[model samples]
Target: MSRDTIRADLCIIGAGAAGLVTSAGAAMLNRKVVLFEAREMGGDCLNFGCVPSKAILSAAHAAHTVRAAAKLGVNAGEPKIDFAAVMDHVRKAIADIEPNDSQDRFEGLGVRVIREWAHFTAPDTVESDSVTVKAKRFVIASGTRARIPSIPGLDTLPYLTNETIWQLDALPRHLFILGAGPIGCELGQAFARLGSDVTLVEAGTALGAFEPDHVAVLREALAADGVRLIEGTGVERFSGEAGAITAHLAGGETINASHVLVAAGREPVTDTLGLEAAGIEADARGIVCDDRLRTANRRVYAAGDIAGKGALTHLAGWHGSVILRNLYFGVPTRQSSNPIPACVYTSPGLAQIGLTEAKAREQYGGKVSVTSWPFHDNDRAIAEGDTAGGVKLVLGKGGKLLGVHVAGARSDDIAALAAITMAKGGTVRDLTGPVLAYPTRGEAIKRAAGKHFEPVVFGPFAKAWAGLLSALH
Candidate 1:
């Protein structure tokens, strides 16, 4: 090792969501924090993931709205999408949000930001090319990268991953995507609406982690948007070049596409971190951490995608808070106890919190109750002419909220309300009491909650009582 060395109370590796949060929080607590990044400062979320994808989705939604306006009595002309300008918008979003996660920002916050690759050389020490860092604790926030599956001939063809998809100079003629998870579904619908013939191929059920009914609604929405969704199939092989690519499916179907975008999955970036030297246990998934986010070595902790909790940006930030609580304030907190919310930003959107209906059924069996309300019943949804999906709430005995699954316009916003309710140990009854404004999508929540009491509200006894009251009146 070189003579150059740095010392800090906290040393964070990888400058993504988790690393950035931990660095900023620790430094603010008046602790000496050193942050390291081998790639972009903002990592996957800011650079290649959420920000860019959402920007493209926004543009796609605008195009879709113009075409959909006919039903609303608006005669908007056909959208002329400038592909190059769309890419520029994506880049501008990244640029606008870049400075908040830049090296100068952290440096200004009194953090020593190191722009280099770091690896564990000892239990308490990490080394890079120019400097060695000895810290009281280490946090491995090295996020994930796009996972390329081992399809035959895949390596020989040019394909798009999240990292490189935003760089397209021209719109694809026919876009073929693999996987029907959030990434694949979101981008597939976006490109399809933007005038590309899109085919989304998924090996398992689409949105496998969500409820079947919710997935069905999104499937219909995507189909209506001109995306050819091929589920229960995997890519067996790839051939041809960038302009004229082909995918052979496991079921023997062949797809001819102008471009291939692999949204299959993501793998943790832990291979180069030299974890064995630090006695930190990590596998193909990510670092093996306890509920407190501590690795096998007590002095080392992990967060974000490398934590193996979930590859979500918000969860990564939550992990950072857990680290800060446990390390800085001596507060014991478990990462699993917190409610995790996820969303797929399609036109109708799909969002979920806590357990899915399938998981609730599997665990509680007869003890769970599922209530639902359709978007068509909502005034705003009908008025907006976007009534395609609905909301489902999974409750345990006594109406205790076990989960919330929403698929429709503003589903993410509705799921956020459910998250707060669940976080406070509230129940379906709790949601029913709130008098939300009329003619809004939010009223769907109260309507969904009212279903849990429908038996009491509409039973024979209630009808008899209503007859008595009518006679008295």
Candidate 2:
């Protein structure tokens, strides 16, 4: 058998959002671009992570709304859930978006798309099952996958990860989750709402990296939604028998579950790609990239979840664009650590952008101002009967908005707006002067901004305001 050889200006591995975007941009520049993918083109986000999860969450939300119809003076019974149909809806959502990332679409854009597992044969060359590709510059956007832990008897038990959890034909009678990160919390709540007994066990605290206050709010909501949240606990091991998996905790507690999900963390897909051939550096954390998303090897670059920074799809898109700018134009675009928003898609989705109160105080020596407003006080929230969440704004000494975190309805969309303001170095005054639409959740932003009014109004203008008011009277 003869090995095939192909050459291109740029070779990109992994046809997820990052690889696809990079391929499209390079092809537009008339650069000979070749992209490789081992499996699906859209990667985990479209196939397993964001798209499918959101679709499932939406169905769960509708079911929840139907159950709550009694409060609105409408007689509605409990939602009848057909698990297979729900899974179909999730698959349909992915299929609907698949064509945009199909191989034909990239081919139309002048990109050579190859479906194969590519490993580096040299710094400039990669060999797959069928062909060998060589290029001047290479991008590894292989993305990350669920970090499967080494638990005794785990291999014998059937388990779920974000990747295969969506393919479930029927909802498990009891689901035991082993992480309290964004994915665990979101999926746990959705399953609980859909009538599954969900137990979310966190090794540390729930939403461990978030501000303590935000965690408190989210924890309360999850508890109210009938999720058995176990924080600051560790899973000692797992035992599988009689078609069920039993998770033994460190404290001698055991949770017998029909299914076990390992949402602990994610490991970057850099290990199998043979980075040494390119002299690139990576570890369990991820590929070590500089500010420009360039690896130790100057000719190579990395982005998206593989970069191991912000793992959101939006950030992946942003990083992809930056990689192209740095690669093509020689314009060094640095990835910003600030103003990245992360959203948890639960009943009341938690959207967090910028810095948390703890982080801001740590960085600024306590010269930070924090203010918030609950959705219960907002008109839209009251009408919608989802007044369980709120928004928090963090600011530094110079009135620089450090972060805007929201946990409520449509928070993902709202957080994008907050990201824009924080990215531009916006301040409370910027939020104050704006007349937000009436009867909307966004009004909470303005309401939170109003907290700054008391100090300003009472400090220097207190006597002037009293005199003016007395004269008018």
**Among all candidates shown, the one with the greatest TM-score:** 1
Candidate 2 TM-score over all chains jointly: 0.95
Q: Write the per-residue lDDT of candidate 1 for residues 324-406, one digit (tens) a residue.
A: 99998998999987889999999788899988877998999999988999999999998888898899999999998999989
The TM-scores, one per candidate, come to 0.97, 0.95
Name the regions of candidate 2 deviating beyond 4 angstroms: 462-473
Model 1 segments more than 4 A misplaced: 457-473
Mind giving the per-residue lDDT tens digits that candidate 2 earns over 101-219?
A: 89999999999888889989888899898899988989889999889888888877788899989868888899999899999998998899899999999988888767677678778
Against the unseen true structure, what C-alpha lDDT does each candidate score?
0.92, 0.86
Backbone collision tally, model 2: 0
Clash-forming residue pairs, model 2: none
